[model samples]
Target: MRIFDPHIHMTSRTTDDYGRMAAAGVRAVVEPAFWLGQPRTNPGSFTDYFDSLVGWEPFRAAQFGIRHFATIALNPKEANDPRCRPVLELIPRYLDKDSVVAVGEIGYDAMTPEEDEAFSVQLALAVEYELPALVHTPHRDKAQGVKRTLDVVRESGISSGRVVVDHLNEVTVGEVHDTGCWMGFSIYPDTKMSPPRMVEILRAHGLERVLVNSAADWGKSDPLLTRRTGEAMLEAGFSEDDVDRVLWRNPVEFYGQSGRLDLSETADTGPLFEGSSILRGGS
Candidate 1:
């Protein structure tokens, strides 16, 4: 059961984490630039974060035989801090870099006006670059957040096929699916959706144009979540084809549209590293 975790924050993980992910059958991952556990105080931090996402992280994944790719964006939670504007301004310069597949993990959090502003700006960037957009909906007021995300997508005019609405649970899944955009589920440990409930969503949604990920970061989360979800699906009586479609095919089809997912032509060797950490060079 080869899989592709369409969402993850590999920057927060270790090389041994990558090895465990590969051993668990993860073939590739799409890591979106997001808020670190702590708030970044300067634009320089954000620049370094983006640099690592495209540089060392891919090198580390390669070492474990897992292909690495990323989506670049200004996370919603950080949008409120006026200090983040300069970093947001720098997004366009790197949006088209080799491993960047989308402008993403950008949407609403707490449904704040600042989040809306940042989301709108990044959504336009995705349209301008003709790349797919991965949206992160709110954990609170989820229904309204999902609706607001859809409205922005429609207004951005980036085709629905190019937008992925992530972090959906049962409450908002139907609405996200109804919007004609790709649906994403993050199977987390205590918060967000769990593996048992994920199987229930799969049972209801039927695995078409859907993706599953760990969204694993510095917080308490598991990098092998995709495998656990797959295991749950198997226990729930899903066929291998069903598992492949949701876990592998859908994400590949979505990110492959970015023209960066060509693992076939690239060498299978894992990415390079610095010490135990994946090192993305300083700008």
Candidate 2:
């Protein structure tokens, strides 16, 4: 089935990952602006990073026949850094770009005041821009964070349907699913949801606004997890249409709220750098 990973960090992955994703039937992906491990010291750093997401990364994905889209935001983790907080002012400009389908990976990280400010401001920007949001629920103290997250979202006046509460699990899914927002599951190898576990959630949740993503990055993650989850769904007695809805259609419906989700390929596509090769030599 054709798949769309609604959240991934293609900035940290190689061209090979794109090729593999294309091979595995991943036709489109959304890479959210996230903390790049090292603390960024200034807003200019965010500018450059955002440029690459809209510029270089999409070009790279196109070479592999995969459409690339991005979500722009000052990630919650970086909001706590005093020097990095100025990037919040830079976000509005990126939000106006065509490929920016959402204001995302934005939510509580440490549940700090700084994170709260960034989350609120960005959510407001999403409202002003008429864009959807991809909210990243905190990994630690997650249950508490999820409640605080939904509370803030309620106060933001942004429609819950326009918000996607990501990185959800069994414990948190019930609450997040209760909200009108879309639910996101980040499948990983040893931690977070596994492919089988994702199928289990689909069994329990019934796959309405559910989104499954690999969330692969510099960590020990698998970029093919979306494909694996689809395969598992088929194994778990999910029909082809069921797999299609969760893996592909769900992301489309959520991000399509932007009125900016472009899956069509442009003229700017074909082989790798300097005309090297991702193709095999012999038939």
Candidate 3:
């Protein structure tokens, strides 16, 4: 029951969460650039954030023996802010870094014209950089959002197989099934698909290109939901190999398109990332 959480927000999580995830069999994760709950005022904020994604987060995950990779983008919510739009120019710098596996969390938030432009532009960047994409469909009007998402993906000229439309439920999974793109589901404690529900999706869809994640963030989410979902699959009579394909191999195949995923065991280093330590009082 090894797991690769294809979409999670570990930047907002605690060091304890990392230990728990590793114990739950989560060996790897991809954290996509997303909104900070509040609006970011300038591109400099994103610069620092992106730096930590490639730098500090990986160091922290390594302490728990988890390999952390990141995706870079100017997220949909902030794309509407004139001051933050400059972050677009800054993304290419991170995209070239080895740790960046994709360009992502880029898609419609409010579905404004501003979101439309940012989505199109970043999808173009993914094409140019030869990285995969992790797209976030709007939380509201999900069915319509997925339809529009597939439409924009079609126009971007990037291979559909390289894109993942995430945060989907039963209502929207079929929309992406035959599109040549991968489907993603976030198993949450509440307000999203639960373990039993996700098992049903896998049962119906047959786990060819499906990715299940915990998507834990700075909210009431659970980092172990990925593990819990795997348990549910077994209880529902899915073979161990079937569980492996959804939780592990599917994400490997999707993000592997980047040619940058390094699943090598991350060696634990001295307690410091740029003079900062995950320890207190030099423990």
Candidate 4:
């Protein structure tokens, strides 16, 4: 089964993980700009991080035959840091890049005032860039986070169709479903919803604009969760087309709206991009 994970933080993962994902039938992925698993001290840090996403990361994924794309934003967790807030100013430059598919991993983290400001600002960026937004709903008070996230998106002047509210669960899926935006679920081991639960949601809700991802990153997340979800769907009697729609086509339909998703071009047969090559001077 072909796969396209809409929100995995590959920056924290290894090249081995990339090989494993490609071997597992992952043809493409989007690595949203997110907190670096630790506080970033300044905007320069964000600048370099953004450079790597647009430069180094895509080159890395391509070597393993995976099409990589990224989203740019000041993540909610760091929005509260006065020092890190200037990263907002640096976002616009990166949005214009071809590899940047959306403005994302942006939404409430702690639901603080700073997070609110950053979220509102980046939504405008998504509108200006004419790209889709991949929103990360909070891990706690999830229902309220989704509610507030919808309110911000509704007021952002960007159409709900251009937004994907991610990290959704059973309790939060109902509200996100009611909205016209796309629904995203992260299937993980201990943190987010499980594959069986995700299947149940699909059974109860039906798949239209739904996207499922491993969200594999620095945690104990599995990069093969997309394949596992597809397997569960088949075991539960969903046809190949049904599995294909959720794991692959649905993500294409959503992120493709950006006009920057080029999985074909992304799979070019070449050495890594110059100076960004992971295959040089090493074993």
Give each model's clash number: 6, 0, 0, 0
The TM-score between candidate 4 and the true structure equals 0.94
Q: What lDDT score is found at residue 86 in candidate 4?
A: 82
Give all TM-scores, in the order shown: 0.92, 0.94, 0.95, 0.94
lDDT of 3 by residue, 1-283 (tens): 6888999999999887877787678888999999878788988899899999999899888777788999999999999999998888989889999989999999998899999999999999999999999999989988898999999999999898899999999899988998989888988888878999999998898888898988888889999999899999999999999888888889989998999888876433322223234665488
- Lowest-sum lDDT 10-residue window in model 2: 266-275
Off by over 4 Å in 3: 266-277
Task: State candidate 1's TM-score.
Answer: 0.92
Question: What TM value does model 3 have?
Answer: 0.95
Q: Itemize residue pairs with steric clashes in candidate 1.
A: 59-271, 59-272, 62-270, 62-271, 63-270, 63-271
Evaluated at residue 205, the lDDT of candidate 4 is 93
Report the CA-based lDDT of candidate 3 relative to the real structure: 0.88
lDDT of candidate 1 over 1-283, digit per residue (tens): 7778999998888777887787678878999998988998888999988999988788778766677899998899888888987778899988879889999889998888888889988988998887899999888888888998899889988889989999998899998787789999888899898999999988887788789999999999999889998889999999998888888889989998887777773333443222343333322
Q: Name the candidate that leads on lDDT.
A: 2
